[model samples]
Target: MPVLSTVGGSGRSTVAGLLACALSAMGSTVVLDTGPRLSSPWPAWSSEPGTGLLSLPPDRPLTRGQVHAAASRFPAPDGGSWQVLTDHQEWSHPPLPLPSDPAAWYQLSAIGGWQAVIADTVHPVAHDVLTARWADSTGLTARWCHLPFSVPVLCAASTGSGVLALQTAVKAASAEGLPLHRMVVALAAVGEGRSPASVKAAATMLEPRVRAVVQVPYDPRIRAHGIRDTSRLKSRSLEAGRQLARAVVSSAEAAWGDPLPAAAVPRTRAAAQARVHDTARIASKKVPA
Candidate 1:
């Protein structure tokens, strides 16, 4: 699934982290980081040494183990965690060839092991449908929209302008033949006194049109510290994450018109070895009295 918004500060990363954390309860979850050029907060929040998305193999058919190994861990609930793969380059270093296409991002999540993958995407994919960028629609934005068995989690700030942008975005996406019927919309609270009439009205109109419209409550912690500490997030915020996850699955089910197919491919032996090493490292953290 891809978490996207046409505008910035729509809480894409926060939603992504929450969804990843909430989805981890179902099984293993991993995050395909959104930022590479300017970068996301994945590095700052992570304690482990970052392997980075660039560290992943450049081949078309990537090895699941190697790809998984490159991910940086983010703590989740119940002692479990999710993985994030992003650029950890320094400011002075010359930029490397990063994977800008949706194919590369999609490939990382599809390799295997993870039961759920949340792709944190900042690109205005829906907005692209109405722009000159639509000519090359076979790339990132369109790919996210048209990919099979995929669900798009459209996010918007709970404000007048934000809702307006989302309304336009959804309309453009529908015009481009994207699955608006199976899409999930998220309204992120911007700490306003209350949702403006426009935002509320849009949600009401879009509710029956889309799968579901969820309102993510404003959490002061998210704004002050970013999405690093999931444990400290408010209960309402976490509940919203769970709601988004369920909504995503429900939309997927609606698209399938039946039970969704399960992932059956086994992870590589190398992946198992990696897990063993990870377990050993975690165990090494404990000290005897």
Candidate 2:
């Protein structure tokens, strides 16, 4: 099962949304908002009807039929064939309690041929549930961890509390042996303005656990028109998001020992090397060289 864990500022939701669009554009019928209430303001599914997570009974054990029903609820956007499944529930503003049978629910979802499941999560809850589920599900593996570029307003609002929370969560997940694939660091800026250094700093702190760090240039159009659909984004943002998603997918495939398409492997390797080169350059510049 393809699972993407997006951990960053609130904008992670938007990143997840863009990924869903990218997957759809690639002709994979995707399930967006697989987790409980969506954190980002972007639309969970594509314009196609019935492509989102199924709202299920959180308090009770979910029956197979209930699971199937939930999957059936989402129709393909093109009225074509597709699979469905339930993601985590969005209970409240902060976060809801983990479902009693998270493993079973995750397994049931995996039965469907879900190419990807992007989860937008908060700190402790995101880490706890994903780790538990990954350990339990023989089929499930983490594809990537997304971190959006830090916005000054968001930083001021977070007041350093968010960074601390992220660090703590990453430590906890690592302790639990969660395989963190890649970390996509988004820089949501207007023009030539650089992404906040704090964002890169946070990503650097996560490097040991996060195998890759991708820089996604910020696009003002996403905020202006409220980029709910991938088509709504400029070509640049869409291409950037797609590249990040591909990296995440490659990381997951490598971890599982699954063979990837020959054409894609070289590009992924090149991207990884580029990241190492960029990090080395940045580090060299930072020193008294």
Candidate 3:
């Protein structure tokens, strides 16, 4: 699963951290940091000195076993353990090349000791290693400055380039046999700033465009202390995280569609070429004069 925001400041990283923690409370979960924005707050929040994915040598592609070994455990108050894999601050390494094979990336979560893997990625992967096709589901974050029905609530074309970018990525991924389960997170509504009617309206408005809509109230605790500080987390934010996790898990389970299929085949040379062709076609359709 990829936690992606079309634009910056949609609180994608915050959501990813909470989602990973919530998932961990239920089962083993690892959050792979592939984005450049903000580093995973796990290290700052955890009591133990931790290791990150970037700690491993970047000379060769990382293996699932290696990934598992390198993961730093962050224990939740409920006794569940959350693991995080990110770059280490101590080492100066070159930009790492993510696994080019989407299937292999997918297999990492399916086969390993982990129950789920949350991939934190930047938007517009045109230059990034993790392309849209690599994701089985995308947690898209959209900001709502208004309290109720407003113009461009779902996709403010003039203000939000992320909407179009996300739509394009979803379409392209679908074309490549990866149907993205879109979990839209509506952000920046606090206690009085949020109401049941507003939340319901937002979900209803987004229902047609996304699989599910989850609203996370803006918590001053998280904003001030960062996501790593669990001690000061607000109850409302925690509940929202749990809700989002349940929705994501349910969507994933439903996608399996009873009697999960056998393991997927690796991407062969021919398949890679076909993917290139498909991507080129998609690009051609969008290119302007």
Candidate 4:
């Protein structure tokens, strides 16, 4: 599952961590960070930096061990640890040497011993899809967001603009033939107060379009410090995480059966070439090379 945001600063990564923590507490899970690593917080979550995706060789077939070696594990609720795949490299240059292909990451998830994989994406995927960006996208967005089994968790802050952004994303997904009925809209509380009438009204309009609209309370610790020890987090906040996880799992089942498709992971050479030419034809916006 991909935890995607409609806009930047929607607490997208934080929401992804919450989902990963909750999901890992149940069973094996790997939370892969595919966002811009320079701005990503996954590297700081662990004391020792993970090898990440760049550590894996793209030419060779991926294995569970290779993926595990690249990931850094974090403590979970049930005496287990959740693996996180992210680039923790230190760079002061033009671009980071991330794998050009995004499918390798997905292939690892299918092969790796994990019950769930939460991909924290950076771009506004719904908007891109609605705009036909997928036709040209050769990056992570095209691979995961369009996958049959990948249930998307669209996030937004619980405010006027946030709610409006989320509603717009929902409409975009519907327009792109995405499974909106099986999509979960995560409305995270930005502050402590009753939601504005506009937000409430927008959420009401959104209820019938998507599977469920859930709220995550604002935690002061997260605001001040950042995502660290879950034990230090408020109980209500943890409960909200559980609620969001349940909703995501249910959506997956409804959209793609109990066990999601294990195939359709590998991107063919032909497809890659097509995306490249198409992207060049439309715009110079190619994914990290």
Top model number, TM-score: 1
Q: Give one digit per residue, the lDDT tens place, for model 2 in 46-69.
A: 233332243454444444455544
TM-score of each: 0.84, 0.53, 0.63, 0.82
List runs of model 4 lying over 4 Å from the truth. Answer: 99-102, 133-143, 258-289
Q: What is the C-alpha RMSD of each candidate to the true structure, in Å?
A: 12.2, 16.8, 11.3, 8.1
The 10-residue segment of model 2 with minimum total lDDT is: 148-157
Clash count list over all predictions: 0, 9, 1, 0
Winner by lDDT between candidate 4 and candidate 3? 4
lDDT of 1: 0.78
- Per-residue lDDT tens digits of candidate 3, residues 170-226? 455445433334444444343344344544554465567555666677788877766
RMSD of candidate 1 to the truth, in angstroms, is: 12.2
Output the lDDT of residue 205, model 2: 69
**Model 4 root-mean-square deviation:** 8.1
Number of the candidate with higher TM-score, 3 or 4: 4
Candidate 4 C-alpha lDDT tens digits along 9-90: 7888778878888888777888877766788888877654567777776666667787888888777555666778887776
Query: Residue by residue across 168-251, what tens digits does model 1's lDDT show?
Result: 888878767777887889999989478889999999999988899999989999888877878888999889999999998888
Which number leads on lDDT? 1
lDDT of 1 at 279: 96
What local lDDT does model 1 show for residue 102?
67
